[model samples]
Target: MSRLRTPTHPTYCRVVRASAWYDLVVTAGFATPWTYVLVHDVLSSGGLALGFEALPELDTWQVLFANLMGSVVVVWAVLRIVRPLPEHGLFDGIARTLFATWQAYALAHGASGLLWLFFGIEVAFGVLQLVPWRWGRNAGSVTNDASPTDGRSDASTYWK
Candidate 1:
């Protein structure tokens, strides 16, 4: 069987940490149920809730679903903060894309202007994670992408 290779450069390490932090901050700031409650009860106007004005009051199952999702999401953010994995960047990109899509849908349905701001943030983070690169670059810059350069196995770098 062939072995799968992934990025091992210090530049890649930087991207991993940066993307993970983005995920952690964004998830904690917006994905938590407490934040939802605050926005729904205090900040919300024009019948808007979670970027959707058309959504009615959540029922029993809906509330349970939200709680369950939030619980897992908080865990995910904490894990990202604790362990920065380059491979998870792909999944984070997918997650951000999905979120941006939903926000875009809400905007299309006349939800709120605030949703656009969220969409922008999501898109930006998604791009950063997907790209897996540093912010700036010069021709002289070089990174060691050689196999096991840091004495850490690829498997150990991810999902541990």
Candidate 2:
């Protein structure tokens, strides 16, 4: 049957759009640190210092992992931008777990301030990720127009 439906509440659509934009901004913001660190490492032979003593070893791995995670997040964020939530659910969960690990590592390594900031941002994104787009087949607002029939919605399908 071909079904025609209208949103119960229009504000929910705005919320979904705003949430997606927030995710995009957060993803881009996360990438900034990686870029800054990379440039610092390249420009300064002494390497980037986090207001502490020489941490060449720690810095190397941390920067590498941060860059890799940032790249992954950017891709996920693009998927979210195109498809909205609940589409990349599993990938979002994995990203959140990895972000938690990264936060813990930063805390243990004496970057608690930075860790707390990242933790806060990640928490917000994680909460958004858990939002249900389809609830009990009632058709939640966010996923209503999202279908594999469109190319944009297919971004996260590959991960599933």
Candidate 3:
């Protein structure tokens, strides 16, 4: 049996919001030096306990990069959580694709296997946000033949 698909707007918004929540929870620790220290230790310990290679010790530059990434991601995640718009999902999906690509590169270069966990999540959320969603027949009482004619660029409605 074919599964029924829901409307694009609410489902896409929820997915975007959910990704933001996940980002907030995960990256919030990396936003500060003290918290990043604790996060690094915990991740290292967890890796060893799980029989995976522990994360490498970070130098000052590495720590700075981590904190900077965390700070930027945390702020972006907040914006998505607050607005949860379709445009946000598109941009976030693009960002996730970049993140997943770099993650794959790091994994190939012998970064900790623990990174695979995050890589998987990045791929999942990226795909979820990037996939096109069809409008449901009952959604906003929109008929299947209905199309938007607003002045927005074609790129915005391309997926629709």
Candidate 4:
């Protein structure tokens, strides 16, 4: 009887783990493109009229790269949330805050109010993404940690 129960437990755990991984993959894939667009749009619009205009082209690439990084982070975060692996709440928080701050800065510096509105929405979404849910803290929150070395966990480590 104990042997049967033990086998069942691991099987159940495997199923649960697989489902969690599937969900995270789906979520990260969905969020990645959206975040890329959001950041790209804000930077393009906000940086279009200044000495920063040249910067937006660079920022476009950066946004793409950042989105990729973010997607990886999101996957790891989902896993951590599902499995309760090493706690990354503090770090995720900081990331979200930095995203928000960047959006706000873009809004403030942009040439047009419309750009500001766009940045504002990005800021809001960035904040929402960081909100703690059943899956664990949002990936952005990991940025809040003061220890730079400890804060630098590879976004993909959680998947392993």
Q: What is the C-alpha RMSD of each candidate to the true structure, in Å?
A: 7.3, 8.4, 7.2, 14.0
How many clashes does each candidate structure show, in the order listed?
Answer: 0, 0, 0, 13
Better of 1 and 4 by TM-score: 1
Candidate 1, lDDT over the whole model: 0.59
Itemize residue pairs with steric clashes in candidate 3: none
Model 4 over residues 97-128: C-alpha lDDT tens digits?
Answer: 67557766775676444445444543443343
Question: In model 2, which runs have C-alpha deviations exceeding 4 angstroms?
Answer: 1-34, 38-60, 131-160
Per-residue lDDT of 71-159 in model 2, one digit per residue for the tens? 66677666655654343553564576677787878778775343465577666655654443224444433334434534344333322
- Rank candidates, lDDT, best first: 3, 1, 2, 4
lDDT of 2 at 33: 62
Q: After superposition, how far is residue 104 of candidate 4 from its true place, in Å?
A: 1.5
Q: For each candidate, what TM-score against the reference? A: 0.60, 0.48, 0.79, 0.33
Model 4, CA-based lDDT: 0.45
Per-residue lDDT for 1-160 in model 3, tens only? 2322323455677888899999999999999888999999999999999999888887898789989999999999999887776667878888999999999999899998999999999999989987754444443433322225452323333244
Better of 3 and 4 by lDDT: 3
Candidate lDDT scores, in order, read: 0.59, 0.51, 0.80, 0.45
Question: How many clashing residue pairs, candidate 1?
Answer: 0
**Candidate 3 regions with alpha-carbon error over 4 angstroms:** 1-7, 133-160
| Residue 58 error, candidate 1, Å | 5.9
Q: For candidate 3, give the lDDT of residue 60.
A: 92
Model 4 misplacement above 4 A: 1-63, 111-160
